[model samples]
Target: MNHTLTFNWMMGFVIAAMALGAGQAQAAYVIPMIGGAQLGPMDGTPMKHLDISFDGTNLSVHVDDMVPTPLLRPLESPDEFDPAEPWAVLTDKAYNYQYGWNPAGFITLPSNSAIWVQRLSQDSGLESYQRPPASPPYASIFASDGDIWQWSGSMTHNVYAVLNPTQSVYSASYRVYLGDSVTGVALDGYGSDDVTLLFNATVSAVPEPGTAMMLTLAGAAMLRRRRTA
Candidate 1:
């Protein structure tokens, strides 16, 4: 083939490869909140305001500060409440007991998406009251706008309360799970006081192997054209 024809074919292949690569790459981003305002005077109020960006794909949040309040019925024997295995109310009304806005504040997740919370780390105290254990892991704790609180098996108990008067600091990392259909999440700190919270997220764009190979081939084509010229 003539040089002109060969060059044209190579250019076409490169453009096609780049388009294919771009299509295969999934975009990812991170949203972070640092040094947030404090919440509360122990008045059973929610505080701390923050915002989150959820655009369909997987995202994670790192929380530093604030505390979560687990709502359970008053137990006849408060001592019987185990911090390690705190119980949650089983009834659908239990949603009221779960408070998501305490530690990290209110979070709005994508509509119609099944949410998942994976605890990475935490430092706080659990205040337990006698209440029936909700379904395992308390998945139902978060119910759209009404209830957005989350709990971790690794944490102390059902209620993540601040007991010390000296302002003890708390920090935790969590992986938020949102189904494919959900997008655009919002979080706010409304009931917390005397504590500062911070959040950070890491996003990545993952490309398929085929896409990576095509990108490499496209680079080679450019180099060949340069040399021939």
Candidate 2:
């Protein structure tokens, strides 16, 4: 066997092996949802729940429940609401249902992906969106459970293209919010206005360096055998 040809073959094998190993090593990345109800004189305690997971190509989001506390101040008239906003605006305060209470935080993910609804609980007032407005950055909104003031159920949202092999491992971010209403509404100040929920997710991919190295070594061993023959 020609020396040059043998070297080429060996390199190819090593590359292949490394790729394989790296791919196997790649695993999902999980992020936990952290937050709960917010209580204040002007604000009502609404429970927001979330669970998220990412397997490189797809992102799964689940909403456990969203319940608005009766303690919230009710709107005096319909004119206090804003129809143009993606979220609900009641009276002078704006209730952000598009993104969870923490609008500043978001999950990282890839671009140009579509969201698939796997499960939607009946009567669970939850609305969803791929992208939302800019003001208060948020991934999607799990709208209210219809006319019902409180909601209890789970819904799965699968977001595709969460990770791209060609781009950096962490390239995109996803923000999610779950609330009782798409547009802010008046709450009757009453009991504990606590929002209870959970959010967890993960992102992952196969690495290439290690796998490539293994392939190269294998190729070299084969090449040696050929030479001996």
Candidate 3:
């Protein structure tokens, strides 16, 4: 009888462990890039205004041109970039939430114009898990116009360990559309050379229920073992 009971209990524990591991929730939340403009120009030109958005996988750029000129284009099949690479950074602000921005870098425009960027993220209470890398730096893209833009170039941000609700932080990199409005920059107090890139991102994390259940089961097992001994 004792052996049978012990075997049943061990089996229960094994099942609980498997359930906890499998119950994790991996989710990613995306907020489109809206309202932005370039502040300065790299070639000494005035700033520009642009429109941008993300498809949770890639960036979609829309440029407001006087004619039918395509301002920017996204890289085709850009699912090759590593998420762990630090292409941007988030600043732990004086407030509760951190500031998110893109890393400073060059993206080839379809119009053959290389534009600098400062990608900005919407204010959300998302936590960071690791420090941003130094090589591929992130930058701060301020909000201007109805689209996000950069006057001079890409910006760099430093990542800090964030206490995310899901206890997970994941990032991926890809090339997307970047556009600018010829007239909106100056009106929005930005230069006309900035562009916004859309990205298709996917993030994952463990759910809370599974974690809590596992902890409870562990404690129970420990207590049982102590009583039996």
Report per-prediction Cα RMSD to one decimal: 21.6, 21.3, 15.5
lDDT string for model 2 (1-229, tens) is 4766755776776668667777763332222111111223244443343454444443445544454322212222223334454323222331223123221124343332222222222212222332222213223433433222212122222111211112222111223222224332322321112222322213225558755565656677777977999
Q: Quick one: best TM-score, which candidate?
A: 1
TM-scores for every predicted model: 0.26, 0.23, 0.25
Tens digit per residue, CA lDDT, model 3, 50-79: 334333234444443432211111112211
* TM-score, ranked from best to worst: 1, 3, 2
- Best candidate per lDDT, number? 1
lDDT of each: 0.34, 0.33, 0.32
Query: Where's the lowest-lDDT run of ten residues in candidate 1?
Result: 30-39
TM-score of 2: 0.23
Can you tell me which runs of candidate 1 are displaced by over 4 Å?
1-45, 49-52, 58-113, 124-158, 162-167, 179-229
Off by over 4 Å in 3: 1-195, 203-205, 208-211, 219-229
